[model samples]
Target: MQQIEFQLEHEFVELNQLLKLVGLCDSGGAGKALVATGEVCVDGTQELRKTAKIRAGQRVRMGDVEIQVGSST
Candidate 1:
């Protein structure tokens, strides 16, 4: 599996924002659509909430990309 690591500026990152930050979605709107369609999985569970509160150390997967969320500091 391809592993991609990224940091959330704040303690948490919204599902849409995380998608954009990790280059999964081109824009917020696109991310929203993806999340709404139940294409996002958090820790291997399907997540349908567009604004799901993702915290540090969490893993987010959409399609073929997987990102590991961490703190910037």
Candidate 2:
């Protein structure tokens, strides 16, 4: 699995944006499609919200890529 630590600049990041930030997809649209098709997970539960509010300490996984959200220091 590929691990990515993403430092949030705000209280949260949109799900699709996070996917792109972590290099999981080529674009935001692609990320949305992946989420819509139920290919993403948040904290071990399947997440279908394309614009889900993903805050710090959250873990998002898609296939072999996993992104760990962290607060910006």
Query: Candidate 1 on 28-70: residue-level lDDT in tens?
Result: 8998999998878999999998989999888998777888888
Q: Clash totals for all models, in order?
A: 0, 0
- Candidate 2's TM-score: 0.93
**Root-mean-square deviation of Cα positions for candidate 1 versus the true structure, in angstroms:** 1.1
User: Which candidate number maximizes TM-score?
Assistant: 2
**Candidate 2 per-residue lDDT over residues 1-73, each given as its tens digit:** 9899999999999999898888778999998999999989999999998999999999999888889999996
Q: How large an RMSD does model 2 have?
A: 0.9
lDDT of 1: 0.87
| Per-candidate local distance difference test | 0.87, 0.92
- Model 1 poorest 10 in a row by lDDT: 1-10
TM-score of each: 0.89, 0.93
Given candidate 2, what's the lDDT at residue 42?
A: 100
